[model samples]
Target: MQPAPDRLSDRRFAAIAHFVEGSVGIKLPPSKRIMVEGRLRRRVRALGLSGLDDYAAHLFDRGALGAEAEHLVDCVTTNKTDFFREPAHFDFLRGTAVPRLVGQRTDRTLKVWSSASSIGAEAYTIAMVLQDMVAAGARFHFSVLGTDVSRPVLEQARAAVYAEAMVEPVPAAMRQRYLMPSRAAGDARVRIVPELRRLVQFHSLNLMDPSYPFDRDVDVIFCRNVLIYFDAPTQAAVVERLAGHLRPGGYLILGHSESMAGNGLPGLTSILPTIYRREA
Candidate 1:
């Protein structure tokens, strides 16, 4: 009988689950065994291994994990993203937050961080808002920083290209202004304009880290949607760390579903259901 190449032995699944949860704080319960096995196949091919069994052997018996773990983590990280996702946040950012942040700023450039910025959508969305603010004569310069744990997504974010369908949520006017449609015939794709691209930067960061390697005085941080994957303790620690990065009176915006994020956390005021302001 041909081997079931994608299947993982129960022992191998436990080991992989432990490693994944420890390294990245993402749970890989027994229910996720199928998902993890499927995702690990990418690394199996990348390493020229025969199958998941061989991949597990390579990681455990051969001790190849230290060198290959990043690739392994990249495969498993969920990077669901879209342009202008959760439009209400952007509306609040533009209509209320920016003006207030500007009013309180001492620096010329407002720094915006998209923590967990999968493929740059959230960060670029922020850049578009700030650019529009300046274009509409709101007096302040702005720069956006996009950070994610996955190296592959950061590379894609830096590339600044997307399928046309992926950009559908971007309004028509912003599309015309900020996206350069692919010139190649029949290529239904677009790349963000260089001007907007220049305003945003992508970096690799793990929210599980003890400390983030970035500025502490960020004006606003969009850490939406990514926290739900973590256990409660991890979520709280990450939230506190993110709060530490905010300037006093700066904002930390969680996803709509994460409205309870800052509950009982110090120096944070729940300004909106999911929006918390750091104490000044």
Candidate 2:
């Protein structure tokens, strides 16, 4: 009367793989099928479903597809990031990009976008760098915006609190200046200082969407480590959209392992490791 459990699981995995690949261009291999199952098992149990089959049917039938889809995408997407994860890029920004941009434009204000900013480390790192530059008499105005597709991570970013382990790599002096030591009610955790928190903003953004909402073009965009999850066509589309949001001579930073070599974005050139710049 009922389908076998393994058969149902296979069906569900197929459906999920299809949904994810279609929505975000992530190809989940058979090895990761168990990963998907493990992550969603709690959801299935919470919904009081018998197995993956029933859950998959419910997802399609009850219009719970959107939420379930988001959960799947969030689980598979890696968020391995830390403060100053790649120091050299920040160094380049400070020593080269910032000075050049400041020289080209007398106005001291600059806007930066962290396009796939997971839990805000990349964005906050940018803020710290900008603050240091300002302290060194650069006299530049800076605003950092971090965006991601996951609502849960975005909420965490807005909170600006990180576990003790996450802040360990942060320089002692920068930690003293940018973070406050405190213990959560039950857990001992250090949180970012209010001053640094005020410097960055977080929002939910879907890169695949056709439109972006920004009044002024951004001066720099850190879209690091995100393109690997996207297919070629999607990656090209995203690069084009990101390029459109940049001012002339603006910068686009990708993950160290990523390349836009064949993407055909004419005005952009690879200036540094995984960093591209727009023609002035």
Candidate 3:
């Protein structure tokens, strides 16, 4: 009367893959079927379904896709990121990009966008770096905006709480200055300090959208690691849309492993293998 609990019908897996790709630009191939099943298991259990078969039935047969889609997307897209992951990017921003922008501006303000910020680590890391620059007499004020498509991760980003071990990559002085250790004895958690938290904000944004609803003249945009999940066309389109947001002379930083070699980003020049500067 029922299909095997572990078997997600190939047809349903195809449907899920299509929806994921269409909704978020994340290409989930058949090779990722097992990953999809594994991530969806908890959702299936929560819905009191016996397995992926019942879950797919609930979605497609019972007309639950519209109601369940966001949660479905959230379950699969919670990517792992760390404070100061890929430290060299921040070093480049601090040493070269910031100074270049400062020289080009009469105002003392900077805008940084973490286009795929996950759980706020990347945004807060930027704040920590910028605050240190200010302390060292870099004359500028800065704001950081962290956006992601997943609501659950955006909620985590807003809360700004992290396990103690999550902050390990943060340098000692920054850890002491930008993080607030839990007052509860034996508790191992920290919150971004109020000062740093005030400098950052988070919102939900699906990169697949034709146009973003924020400032177009962003000074620095960190869109790392995320493009890998997309197919070449989606990656190029997303990069184009992001390039549209950069101010002239602004920088777009990609993950070390990601590149724009064949993307044909017009008006953008390669600063490094992974960094591009908009034409001034």
Candidate 4:
């Protein structure tokens, strides 16, 4: 006889939801139950658990899920990203931010952090822009740090490969300068050119942490599209943390849909649709 089909019950869903929010700061409301169930069923099968309820029980079973916490966080988090997903932000960085940095700073080293970089696309995009600036006589050596909560995406981001279709938004000149066609048999992919790849570093980061692990303030931070997944309070907390990682007068770029209207964050002034600056 076949095994019984797993059903993610309301109670079980609530438990999983609580775990996710508490662990990662993502708000998975009741409406996401179905989506959560669909994504988590793979975990159930992989672990050879009896069903969704069993999986939930295991998760809460007195530290039984110890090291599995990272995996659970990975399974629940969304890692959707693309090269130049939001073009305007890149344009702003290239045109406004870089120029100001180059003219103002006596030091020629520029640092940028993509706080929620999904698969390295955004970081690499920043790299390409900086490279273009360097080619055009900008006197700065750029460094980009791409961070995410998901280990899988961080690995992918470090690998720096993407499907051809995903590279569509990358400008032709940039595609030529920074991407190399994958030569792997039957794989129509492109890898970030080594020069650009060397400019970026990837690491795992959980936004829920009380503080970030950075030792130096960066010139710019790209944290777009991540705040929407968090509740208002979480959004505010995260924005505050991100702001602390920026230098005075540095820029903070959020998603177009996210706002700091009630965040009570001090020292950040709105500059554009979703752009803010740390008061110098």
Candidate 5:
């Protein structure tokens, strides 16, 4: 039997670390070295490479390997988000954030950003909520934008297709209103209705960049469960970039387990548990 490959030789590990840090500002911990190695082992074998070192060399030597590098990053990075994953954040947006902002607004439009939206669920959820709010005499124009570093996932988000299981938690009434069931090649799939798709957009964004652009001021930013992957310094940088896009008096929602206390955004005020407001 072939000997097991060396997962983390100093050179190969450094290359992987540099790729992730440069691309997404995420610093993979030493604890994850073996985990990354294990995940990529199969890919190396499939490529007819002998070990991690061989694969890393190929990644650097070939231009076509860029896509594979991206695939590796996507595979290693965590993307465990779901629709309405953090119910309280959505609740605060519907109950307090929207009403408070609308009361003070000169215009009816509300712009929201999902800073690390994965697979479009979070953005779609926001759209669904806004649709309900609009139907209930809440006359508001809304746009939900989702941004992520993973190109593959962003493509999936743009496609707006999902397994039926993904919609299970979505309220039946809303599901009926927003999703259409269809048979594609004899397999059933749920597609986001044109109305919801029109309200949301997805883009590729690198959070580490100091000068991130927002097309318009954002009223609510849903950046949940994404910051835990970064180091303290990177986290602080990301928070600052995200805060720059939020409209005054708008809200920035973080993961239930994440905090912005030490990241230096004093303008943020905790309004409802995990929900925070950007002071006007």
Candidate 6:
């Protein structure tokens, strides 16, 4: 099959960028136009469309817009993740948050939300930390909810399989305990152990929604490495919504590079670097 020709023009770039920003709150700047074109070419070819222009038209045509917007979000959004990408967050969870939750709560049900859980690594990391806590005789019920804007990445997260390189950050003991060597694929890959997978759930979520559908209060929300893609206002708005989703006294964790310094999000007090607590 012949390759689909590049048809992303300045107008098409603007159109695609606008759709993604409006749909998912990811800001695609002018510098990302080339990256957008490159990433979207695969989608065009996969759909057997004539070119990017045709793909854009197909995306916008009538009833297909809603469904295709999901595909576009999957295409343009980046899903770069790995196990234990940030170690400090896990340390905080183990040393500070878990102890606090277990000591403070009577019911001992701990709920964590991985707000942008691309590929499930972050969610699984949270699970591992909780599992460790349980292993050390801290009696508490815990679960992780991993949500992302891209369905494809959510599917990958649900699968819970990873190549060796992706699992390299996982500690040796964790690799032996929480992951199993895969013989089915006959490759250097591993699957998250069944127990851990059971504790984590993945869902397709758009942060732009007026209200999130979480039924219960979340104890900790990890919206890391995602707000950087959005403009400051969008970041503030997302932070606000995440704050709302938290239980009073719950925590909100952001990427180290993201700053809410001047955002002045109400009801949130910065307790640590990149960590905020919702006021009771």
- Cα deviation at 151, candidate 1, in Å, is 1.0
In candidate 6, what are the lDDT values of residues 204-251, reduced to their tens digit? 788888878984489999989988888887888888888888888888
List the lowest-lDDT window of 10 residues for candidate 6: 256-265
How many residue pairs clash in all the candidates, one count each? Answer: 0, 0, 0, 0, 0, 0
Cα lDDT tens digits, model 5, 1-280, are 9987576677768878888878877787688888888878877888898788788877876654677867778868787768778777778889988998888878979999999988999999999998899998897889999999889899999999888888888889998999888766765679899988999999888787778767537898888788888877777677767777888898888887775532346677776656677776
Better of 2 and 4 by TM-score: 4
The candidate with the higher lDDT, 1 or 4, is 1
Question: How high a TM-score does candidate 5 get?
Answer: 0.90
Clash pairs of candidate 6? Answer: none
Best by lDDT: 3
RMSD of 6: 2.6
Local accuracy of candidate 3 as per-residue lDDT tens digits, 54-144: 9999988999999999999988785889999999999999999999998997987999999999899999999999999999999999999
* Candidate 4 lDDT tens digits, 1-280: 9976667778878877888899888888988877888888898899998778888888886465767788887888888888887788988998999888778868878899999998998899889988998998878898999999998899999999899999999999999999999788989899998888988999888999998898457899988888888888888888888888888878889888885632347989888868888886
lDDT of 2: 0.81
Give Cα-based local distance difference scores for all models.
Answer: 0.90, 0.81, 0.91, 0.86, 0.82, 0.85
For 1-280, candidate 2 gives per-residue lDDT tens digits of 9855432366677878888888766777788877677767777788788777777888877788987777767876777788887788898889888998888877878999998888888899899999989987987898999999888898888888888789887888888888877755767577778887888999888888887786346888888788887777888888888888888888888877676632458788877657888886
Tens digits of lDDT, candidate 1, 1-280: 9855569999998998888889989888898888888888877887889999889899899999998899888887789998888898999989998898888756767899999998999999999888988999999998999999998899999999999999998889999999999999999999999999999999989999999989999989999988888889999999999999999889999998888978889999998899999997
**Candidate 2 backbone clash number:** 0
Task: Give the deviation of candidate 5 from the true structure as CA RMSD.
Answer: 2.3
Model 4 scores worst on lDDT over the 10 consecutive residues at 256-265
Comparing 2 and 4 by lDDT, which wins? 4
- Considering TM-score, which of the candidate structures 1 and 2 is the better prediction for this target? 1
**TM-score of every prediction relative to native:** 0.96, 0.91, 0.97, 0.94, 0.90, 0.93
Pairs of colliding residues, candidate 4: none
- As a whole number from 0 to 100, the lDDT of residue 110 in candidate 5 is 93
